[model samples]
Target: MKILNKTMISVLCSSLLAAGPVRFINPTNSYAAESDVENNTGFNVENSTSTANTHNFSLVNPDTNIDVDIKYTDNTVTVTTITNGAEEHTFTYNQSNGFALLDGKIMNLEINEPDFVIDSEETLSPQISLFATPSDKPVFVSPGNISFSESVDSVGKVVAVITGAVVLAKMIGVTLPKKLIETKVQDALTLIGLGSAIALNTMSGSFTYGLYRTKDKFYTGYPGSVNSYQYKFRYQDMAVNASLLGKTMNINFSEVGSWWFQSKPM
Candidate 1:
């Protein structure tokens, strides 16, 4: 397991370095319409009175502007973008496909299909869609819950102690009482079951939230957005202190980019 983890980390780090110089764009309050993002995600939304069939918006880093334009037709939706007023890029999709993108540098438009239906709120807003930060930085990972390997070690030690007690009891039963030995063995078995259950529950809900960052903004929540590629890493060594829960990761990446986006809130 240790060797496999090291190999995976090496491969991921190599991929990030080879991708290009890491960069981030400044994040601005400028918003992109929710309808444009949802249109690509397959949920039917009533057209905003703001625009009939076309939605035009811009998402900005402090310095760069990502212009987005979406066009809806009978069976398909087309998303177009001009980043910082540079060359245009486009993506087209229909219901079978799951997501749409404005540009790799901007937001990856998606809808929380299951949640949206439950909430029953469809007004155009970022509440249901994922936002993206502009950047070329390959990935950012947030420390998840504590690992349970130590707990397993504790259980093993307890079992060893119980086994030793049982052996000693059997060998010396001529002098020692039998009831005490039976009671101790039963108690040890009970503890083992309880400890195993606790460990399983703790790990069941654990997840590591990751983001890909650029020089200016930390792009998160854009799971399958444009330019988003899948990367994998193990969380064994990466840990978040309880004190730092819900806080922005303030590690290295501070040259021209700031980690204003925190793992907890977003």
Candidate 2:
């Protein structure tokens, strides 16, 4: 009887091993399942590079939405404003300096003073200022400082030779008065001075307090002035790509409308 019971136990164990683990389930539906993940909005990086990046942001104005586009690089920054998907204004700047290229002119940016100030019915625009280009030549001195040292030396030599001749004649009893020699020498010097003045006037045109205009071009009396009037606009951080060697990135500016006048050459 003991041998038969041990044989049955071995067979049962072998059958259980072959069947593996089993799952117990109810015939009726009663349970539910769920996942651990949460829902969220996605994010994206528009333009990414080792040296620069571009980002888009929006500003809500009184009744419209303003889209601002900014591009930042190693040493330069540029900012552009767009409305209704149409470009308005684009401003560019050099990070090393506060100088900006706006409205076809190189402008100096100053933000130390008050944003708005009024005096004597004059309206001062904010952020930037305009300056007139004194002249195409762009000089610190009008007509430039001139020197005629060689011409003066030549005039003096001629006068000396004439004086020596007159003195020699008198010493040899040739009847030439010293007064006459002096008067002639003085007259020659006067003519030289007059001639020099005429030549200078011709070379540089008329100069008032400063050279206002030349034959075909106009000039301003102020320093660092350009051909057109200076325009001021609300300052915005500009987007720039310093890695760009000599290539220019185009940015459309429509905020203040098209440039009123052409930009003068540097």
Candidate 3:
């Protein structure tokens, strides 16, 4: 698998530290909402008063002053972005067509249906493998051994480990050292059977968390053959991670340009 260079990782670390955390708060409520009503996807909802078939909320990032209004009805989800109290852009997604429309125009993007497999292999080993594409061709494909554990649910364990690392780093100090960030990334990668240096370089760019496998096998067919193994997994909502400056930034990936990340003080 192709890995990200050290220079790229360093640049990403610098950018995230400078930007700081982007808080997600409910406009209707004075306090922040901690739990999600629909899914355990970590997104904070603002308003929950809507028809039983429809769900409405706003994702406001105070740091950026960007308010994203999301409405879900049946299998259709519409996202509208408002900046500086003005509508900037809007996008709609329908579960029936699996296509996203931007401002009423259909875009050249396709949202693939998720294919989840649960078998004996998953019961034996659990790991996460990432595969992403900007177009029809995939630009990033990581090995299935990104995060592994002896536990039956390695995916959950990996998420907990990364989350704990972020919290621990925040407790350490405001300005985190480079070594500390490297150490945390290395620790998580080590659990998946990869060296520290390899893990850091491999996870430098846009990486998602939902593509995983419970089987220990990394690939199926021959490496250079035409029938070589390929990843066909996709999900509507994906958890994206970026480890920078001793903190792991968690972002939910819904579309190409409609993604947001939250950073914490460390």
Candidate 4:
């Protein structure tokens, strides 16, 4: 009876092993696959001559091999890629303000203080505030002190140069002195003095002072790890007739809409 009982137990265990072990058989073996590591969105690096140039970037390939279409509107960018050769590939997508977590080297690249409007009317010493790009968000990077706050030295340098020029010209006879009478010298001196005094008082420039356009390009990273990316979108109207209303922009197509194409030069 004991031998028969042992035999039954052994046979039952053998059946479970041949059928497939529920406890010991590993499912992870079937699940293993190549790690798909690729970026979907392209980084718009400006003047990044190399891969490491963080600001100067190239488009990163999307994971899984697929042909793609890229689109943009306002500050948003979108990409659509064909997933399969035939079901053929039909996919739709939309994205906005997409960004990737860059490697540490990218964040470490130098960024200067952005051009800011000094609001003297509201505050006693309204500091310089950095602005955004193709945007108005706060600057990603900025200097603690702006080149705006203490521009007296700059003013003085300019003024002194002018003064020296005048004095030197007076000595060199390139300029007409008051003694020259009815000469261009007297008028020039008068204008010079007036301009100098005003410039001196407004050393830091007037509240309205600043460069018209900001620098939009930057750099990042070492070679091989990061990519440099840059992108531009442009559209032109092709119409035989058009009209403009107050505070409104309108485009009227005569027979057909304008054509749009996108690509970078080799």
Candidate 5:
């Protein structure tokens, strides 16, 4: 079942990519649309209606857009993301001349416990081991970059911590005479003060997300049905904290992408 879903979505997304761009509009607002971002995922809306509410409008593989309203009363979520994904997938044709592809759902999204973790110092890491249970292992070659990311401003952190520590030390009477403040002390202070920064610099995490559209040509499907494909929105996350520090802070993200197949075969 999961396999069928993945395969179907792959086909749908591919159709959007093969044909042309798609549009989504809430009708309540007559706002401008986003120009196709080169292979970028996610979207930033340009709304014209004064009464619009906040929502997330996103596009997935092959090319499909969904508007998720943040509130029930909010009636302004529309506009589409342009897409260009592959339109065809190759399949082997053997003695089985005609195999009808069965009908099945083409999508999946599961954000179980947490495959991601962020530390108190704002370092993020992804645990790749907790991706998906392989009901149907859709060949996960590699999606693009997902924004449930981990980034640190090392320099900014150092300066802030140093200043705070210096103030705290002065308050505690840990001050040495200026003449006796040797370069070695300065260096040692720099190192000890940056314990958190060092953890961040040494920390590593991984995550992947984006529009990945592909077609699965089933030799057994009905005549026109061959044009079908599925749009797949995939994610894999499982992150842990540095051994020195238990998981103190983290950002969790669950994602979705729409799948709608299109074809102009006569």
Candidate 6:
């Protein structure tokens, strides 16, 4: 009976070893299995949603380039130019005074009356200004300056040369007509003296004051002066054409002591 009991105990132990451990499962739901499935599906959906959001963001914004910047205030207008995404030049203009500030320097604008009157009365003589150097300085030119007298003297000399040439030709028995000699001499003198006269005028004196004209207004200013070797002239008062106050002002240098604005070259 002991041997049989021991043998039965051994067989029970072997049967227990052959069978695996027991596991408990909830009848209501398989939470672990459902949780894994849901987690996997949510991860895939999140990835797809993230990709779509990135594509939409790229489409929403495309161009982000800036070239110029302009700002306006009650009294001033500022214009800034940009090159290669970098600031290049800035220009500011004053609406009230018609003055402009370029970079850091101030540009003055002087408005003259319609009658071009100087002092208190209107004058028949017109006064003008010229620029000698490429700089901002201006030199005032008037009839009273020594430079003007020199120009007049130059014309007289040219006349005298023609007269002398005519007399010399008669004395030499060339037998050329006085009018022909005069004409030929005058033409030669003009050709030879044209460059010299221009040089002299440019070097002797220039307009220290700049005159600018707009649609309905005339502007003028001293624009400061420079220490130049050229001589400068000034007058107590001067007059100019009030009608020149139009759009697109041009610098006129037809005469030494006079300047005016015209739509086209005169």
Q: Which predicted model would earn the best TM-score?
A: 3
By TM-score, the candidates rank as 3, 2, 1, 5, 6, 4
TM-score of 5: 0.20
lDDT of 2 by residue, 1-266 (tens): 00011111111222211231111211121112222222111211122222224544443323334354545554444555454455355545444443344323443222111111122223222222236432232221121110111111222222222222222221111222223323332333333332111121111010011111111123222356542232211211111111011222221111111111112322
What local lDDT score does residue 11 receive in model 2, on the 0 to 100 scale?
15
What are the per-residue Cα lDDT tens digits for candidate 5 across 29-121?
111232222322222222212222222222222322222112112111121112222221111111122111111221121111111211223
Better of 2 and 5 by TM-score: 2
- Best-matching candidate per lDDT: 3
Clash counts per candidate, in order, are 9, 15, 1, 16, 24, 11
Question: What does candidate 3's lDDT look like per residue over 1-266, in tens digits?
Answer: 21222221211232222222232211111112222223222222343344433333333223222334445554455655444455355555454554445556553331121123334455324343446222232222222111111111222223223432222222111212222322333333333442111222222222333323212232332455432332322212233354432344454423221111121112
TM-score of every candidate relative to the true structure:
0.21, 0.21, 0.29, 0.14, 0.20, 0.18
- Candidate 2 displacement at residue 199 in angstroms: 51
Q: Give Cα-based local distance difference scores for all models.
A: 0.27, 0.26, 0.31, 0.20, 0.22, 0.24
List model 4 lDDT by residue over 64-133, tens digit each.
Answer: 2222232323322222222223211111111121121111111111111122232234321223333524
> For model 1, which pairs clash?
23-214, 23-215, 24-214, 24-215, 24-216, 25-216, 26-61, 26-62, 135-214
Worst 10 residues of 5 by lDDT: 91-100
* Model 6 ranges off by over 4 Å: 1-66, 95-99, 108-266
Q: After superposition, how far is residue 255 of candidate 6 from its true place, in Å?
A: 31
Instruction: After superposing candidate 2 on the true structure, give the runs of residues whose Cα lies further than 4 Å from its correct spot.
Output: 1-52, 95-98, 111-266
For residue 91, model 2's alpha carbon misses the true position, in angstroms, by 1.6
Model 2: number of backbone collisions: 15
Instruction: Please estimate how well model 5 matches the true structure, expressed as its whole-model Cα lDDT.
Output: 0.22
User: Which is superior by lDDT, 1 or 3?
Assistant: 3
What does candidate 1's lDDT look like per residue over 1-266, in tens digits? 01112111111222212221222323222222212111221112221222545555443334444354555554335555454566465544333232222223222221110000111123111123235543444333332121111111222222222322222111101111222222332333332332311231111111122223322332344565642331222111211111111122211111121233322221
- Lowest summed lDDT window (length 10), candidate 6: 52-61
Q: Tens digit of lDDT per residue, candidate 6, span 1-266?
A: 00011111111222211221111111111111111112211001111111211110000002221122334454444544332344244445454554444444442222211111122222212233344222222332212100001121232222222222222211111222222322333333333332211222111111112222221212222233221111111122211111111111111212112222221111
Local distance difference test, candidate 2: 0.26
